[model samples]
Target: MPTQNPRVNVVLDNFLYQNVRLLAEKDNVSLSAKVRDLLKEALEIQEDIALSAFAEKREKSWNDSETLTHDDVWS
Candidate 1:
């Protein structure tokens, strides 16, 4: 069974629209479906980049930490 997704209206340049239409025809999917797939793919890529940046920041912060013992603090 197919799922029903929300509908949205978007404006694209003629050239881009034609390209997407051709791609959709080639893939045997509706224009809206192809656009949705592309948008989802782009968002996922952006999410991956953001997560990678966060991980790097955490790694650097962990590496920059300085450990001290109770005696070291007293002295």
Candidate 2:
């Protein structure tokens, strides 16, 4: 933990903790740093899923993209 950032207490199942510890060792990073990095990535994936769902919901609303011409909007 960095002195600049406040720390929070966390509990994990022993098996889960062991696996995370192994990953930390493998990555040559402190367990806390590894956990923070993993959490950041998980958050990013969640945001991606949400954005993708919104895009998919709107994708078919467009009639034609490839063959679209300027007059499609004005005429």
Candidate 3:
């Protein structure tokens, strides 16, 4: 049988491999699933960091006089 999902091959050092294997065993999942979940979590964290930086930059340039009120926006 062949899988329809895309496949990726990664090479991990012995220490990392063992850690991933242990996590998979503890979660009762395959190594691939564990890696996929970890990668997803890492990406989400990266996105959150990027968004926070963007918001901080925008905040630095914010001005109350140049902004609209809630009622103004609704009207």
Candidate 4:
């Protein structure tokens, strides 16, 4: 059964499809599952990049607020 509306549809070349099919079969999983897992991983990587950028911004703000040098250490 096919869904009326699929979330995604990609067309790969024969070589690419062959590799994906082989790996999916080796893992005993469907091609759809493999694609879904790849999509999930891509989303996670995007989130990680966003989070890293936000953390870097905060660290810069913190560093800018402190103007003490090593010579004035604990003063």
In order, what is each prediction's RMSD in angstroms?
6.9, 4.1, 0.9, 6.3
Which stretches of model 4 miss by more than 4 angstroms? 1-5, 63-75
lDDT of 3 by residue, 1-75 (tens): 999999999999999999999999999999999999999999999999999999999999999999999999998
Error of 2 at 36 (Å): 0.4
Q: Report the lDDT tens digits of candidate 1 across residue range 1-75.
A: 765966688999999999999999999999998999999999999999999999999887874258677898998
lDDT: which is higher, 2 or 3? 3
Clashing pairs in 2: none
TM-score of 2: 0.76
Best by lDDT: 3
Q: Supply candidate 3's per-residue lDDT for 71.
A: 94
Q: Tens-digit lDDT track for model 2 on 2-75?
A: 58887878999999999999999999999999999999999999999999999998886755646667798679
lDDT value, candidate 1, whole model = 0.92
* Cα error of candidate 4 at position 32, Å: 0.5
lDDT of 1 at 36: 93
Q: Estimate each model's TM-score.
A: 0.72, 0.76, 0.93, 0.67
* Pairs clashing within candidate 1: none
Q: How far is 24's C-alpha from truth in model 1 (Å)?
A: 0.5
Q: Best TM-score goes to which candidate?
A: 3
Per-model CA lDDT versus the true structure: 0.92, 0.91, 0.99, 0.87
Give the poorly placed runs of model 3, Cα more than 4 Å off: none
